[model samples]
Target: AYLSPGVSEHQVLDASYLASLLENSTSSYDYEENESDLNSLPCPQDFSLNFDRAFLPALYSLLFLLGLLGNGAVAAVLLSQRAALSSTDTFLLHLAVADALLVLTLPLWAVDAAIQWIFGSSLCKVAGALFNINFYAGALLLACISFDRYLSIVHATQLYRRGLRAHVALTCIAVWGLCLLFALPDFIFLSASYDQRLNATHCQYNFPQVGRTALRVLQLVAGFLLPLLVMTYCYARILAVLLVSRGQRRFRAMRLVVVVVVAFAVCWTPYHLVVLVDILMDMGALARNCGRESHVDVAKSVTSGMGYMHCCLNPLLYAFVGVKFREQMWMLLMRLGGSDQRGLQRQASSSRRDSSWSETTEASYLGL
Candidate 1:
């Protein structure tokens, strides 16, 4: 059941306590009334089972396949071009790694969602932890990319060259560290258990009494609010610098950064907002009664689906949005076809011709 908005976190705690109380007392029998009511009603169990078997699993399977292919291609391209690595490329590499790791857990989830969490308790905990690691790492990497762009464009000569290698290594290390730290809750809390009513095993978080509130708060801060604030501030600084600067090429690059930041915000904002709202609702600030259960369910479903969709969107943004990336991809493709040497020669010739033309035009303009 979903919690109502505007509900105090304490209320959610109380509700959980109440649930436990009910489970231990006459309230458990009350659930039997609800179940009997549900069972007495005509429901298409066979059709539901069939849909789960045929449609849901197939859809998730397709998602897994696409995610693997897309992320794998990105990793290969980034690794192959390691000699030309920039701050952006460093972040992209981490992003690709995060996506690939996240996708690896999809098969487990697909099986759990379609049939059951056939995997044992250990697998469930590990998969759940990996999922969180991927999510947090991706978010942090995106934030890092935004800051890197801001530094590169606004501070340019000052911050771009000095300590770059060290900065890249540190940022990469910090991102992974934060990912593991935030994912620890998932590893600690996730479990697999058989549900008697559903006659299937489920894998989900099981927060301890002492740590539940702390976990929720940590999730709110680390998973959503902190990253959002970082991204927003970095992009704001980038915009301010762009507006104050005058170079056309720099302006164009700033525009691309803006696009990336905006896309990231748009894609992720709703999901986080939903999560925050759900947390609030769980606390008993929203709807207190059981009548609003459907609304909670809908919100949960939408947020969950949107969060998953964000995983697939990152590769497209990274690989397709920038001119440099496009050029790199084209070069990579040509090289894959064994024409890299010819392509390099063509590029060299074009560069020389452009340089000669620029010099001649300058001389003519000066009448020299």
Candidate 2:
């Protein structure tokens, strides 16, 4: 039960129908080329088949630029310190790499969203695959980073430390493998299908009904929830450790943990909630109406955009916030200042009071 201030019945009804077909799974589903459905749909004036053509592309452009610069800086800084990279830094590097991969596809989607899918068929599939692969990869890498931090803090046993580099490498490999495996659906189902009404091709997934429902649920659980749970568990345990060892630093750890968790939830939960509601409504579990469906359709677009912000946020929350990273960046700046800046380097080196900076920094790298 909802109402828009301005909309016609045809607009509302067509919006509802288009919403159903957007992320839906159906054996009989095809592009809107079927003239019968298109004739009836008539492209709603209120909630057109396409999202806000201007706003969505602008958002994508913004995310692409921010993600590129932020993730690029992270990768460059991390690689520059390759010889001294800790386990957290290694995971952060991979996370940046995954973010860059996802960002690269945003411009393509931006163009497609604004106008039409002019990329033809093959590139459409490749773009779709890149979207799915790097999405899963980024989430999986975040969870991996959390788990690595958990192990180092919660159970820093000698055995665990033995061949730690190898362990980190292997874990990253496994994450990529799982991401590509999960994204196999895109490879199989994502393609450019012609829509007659629009007389344009769209890059989208075409899953059977049951498969669509399952994939939606799987994405909810695997793409977001499971990774969230892993991060929560690791942070909770890490917080427990900090609480036991009482200090001002403990409070900082608590704040960082809360900030990280809250940021993630705020950024991602709405999209998943909208998706879940869509699934439920489609299954007749929720009261369905044209008005509500239209609202949800609008929501799905906005929430999905919000979710993409994670690529830009990752470097800030997970990489640049570390004390060691901040110091290293400063050192890099000093080094980049030409030969006359040698004094800055000497002062920077002389200011290091703790021989155990690496150990302490590892603890802080998880936003300590």
Candidate 3:
């Protein structure tokens, strides 16, 4: 190589040094470019897709059958006795209604999970709103039932004593109104939209990120946490009162209490916890990547199905467990089946004596 006359040995760079520097710079640039490309590429997220297709449809279909049958039976029994409904009866009736409404929407979700959202946008919004509305109403009514039990037992105040059926009806109206308010967002934002990645349309929330976060937070607090807190407090007080009392009713009440608490926790807590994790991930409070997101997706699906199954357990836990309810249900079934009128009358007369004794017990609401 030729050097300029003014260039000194110190000022001139050796060929090897220049070559090494150029190589280093090129490698650094290439690494940076590669990093940028990786960041820009969409991450693979098929971890839960196959699992969801196989799992969600079956879970949803089973829930639909169980919930519909259970809630429908409760509704029939409650409606048959509507003229003489106690405050507890009124709450149970509405709870059954809420659960039924929620269950009716499950078929749509099942079809969506198995294939795609072919129901179109209007039906999607309506079904989504109904599902959410009943979800809130059911939880609130459970809280109301707990409170009713507290008043009837702990305070020794008979809700039906003062012609409070009107009050109970009004409370149910208020619950429905509040649930409607909570679900308004779903009506406005949910739609069946196409997903290119999945090659299907999905019925889902369509909102800004901030709006989604806010809506989810509201749901978590109002729908689940608030009701859970209310039930916890009211039942805790009721349990304290029941503990000091003496009777067979006490033992039965203790069992009823355990069943109620365990059933609620098992069905609901996991779903809400997974939802909380998702909310945290959205807010950047938790580390999130494709793998973690896929796991969360699977968890949400499984847990939400578990939550849906809660509707099936409600009728068993709240109604059939009660002796009075069982009698009423038996009467309803006999009538529906065209059983012998004379036999029905004899059974009714017998039940009246048994019911008189049951009515005096604190757990009469449970029909225990």
Candidate 4:
């Protein structure tokens, strides 16, 4: 067993074997290191700050400014003619108010998305509550507008000849009340919480998982689906009424119905679909992986940004599209800063219209 320290055949074989074993062990270690490094790398669509720091702030800021101006103009035009407003105009006034409130909250959300929730929990709850309120109120107000138009068109002379003013006022109040009620969830559950992953404070929807899911479903159904159905049915009936009449104005009104419906669908559908997908993923129906989840997160942000634009679009699509609203805008501009010629022209036009036209103004203002 005691071998001499010399270069023998057995010693050569033993050294070569040991060298080969060491090489194999080192290769295995390197292979494991490579595997671990590969595993640590993130895939495409990983959640990151790139989306938050740039796109969200810019998008929200633009929306805020545009919404402010558009809604502000609508409110100003309506308020300037406050005493003369018809039931239709009254609903629009409330719609403008709701949009203003909704637009006001955008700066809060914008700042949060850009940096963090610098505003404390109280304001966070307030702002979030306003959003829900405005959302429900806006659509419900549109529904009100639809029904009002329906009543005015189909049974203007008979059904609403008495107590119409009082009835409309009550309906507006009721809409506000119901919107505030639905929005109570925000006040109750919209509290700020620290997200370590995002490494920032967030003022977000943080209800219990079950309640949150149910609430989201309710929002989609009541906030959008029901209103859409009501609007569609109302417009269909309105269209039927128009087909019986023959006027250039009615043709223009027919065009308006198509445009408004298309705009509503475009602005809202994608966002809700994205939200639904996110909910499904949360329920483990879709792939439960970071990449897919991050993609969904990005999509939600995008779609929500799109959704917020609907407030701005409302004035343009629903109100501004009306000839009367445009005329009002011109008159509003004249009141503020237009030339003497425009003012005289408006006055002359007003004088030229027959008294019978005055009775039709309310129905015309509703775009039907």
lDDT of 1 by residue, 58-162 (tens): 555666787788877777767766654556666778898898888778777768757777888898878888887887788888777766665654465324232
Candidate 2 deviant stretches above 4 angstroms: 1-51, 158-162, 334-337, 340-363, 366-368
Q: lDDT of model 1 at residue 183? A: 73
Better of 3 and 4 by lDDT: 3
lDDT of 2 by residue, 269-292 (tens): 998998889789757799866567
- Candidate 3 TM-score versus the reference: 0.86
Would you list the clashing residue pairs of candidate 3?
Answer: 322-366, 322-367, 323-367
lDDT, residue 290, model 1: 38
- State how far residue 77 of model 4 sits from its true place (Å): 1.0
Lowest summed lDDT across 10 adjacent residues in model 3 is found at 1-10
List the global CA lDDT of all models: 0.60, 0.69, 0.74, 0.67
Best candidate, TM-score-wise?
A: 3
TM-score of each: 0.75, 0.82, 0.86, 0.79
lDDT of 3: 0.74
Supply candidate 2's per-residue lDDT for 213: 72
For candidate 1, which ten residues in a row score worst on lDDT?
Answer: 358-367
1-368 in candidate 3: lDDT tens per residue? Answer: 00000111111122223334445554346655567544534435455667767887788788889999999999887787665566777788899999999988888877876788888999988888888889999899999888877787888877644266678878899999998998888778777776555567777665566887788788788888999988888788877988898988788888887788778878989988987887887799998775676677677778887888899999999887877777778887889899998988777677655542124238564467
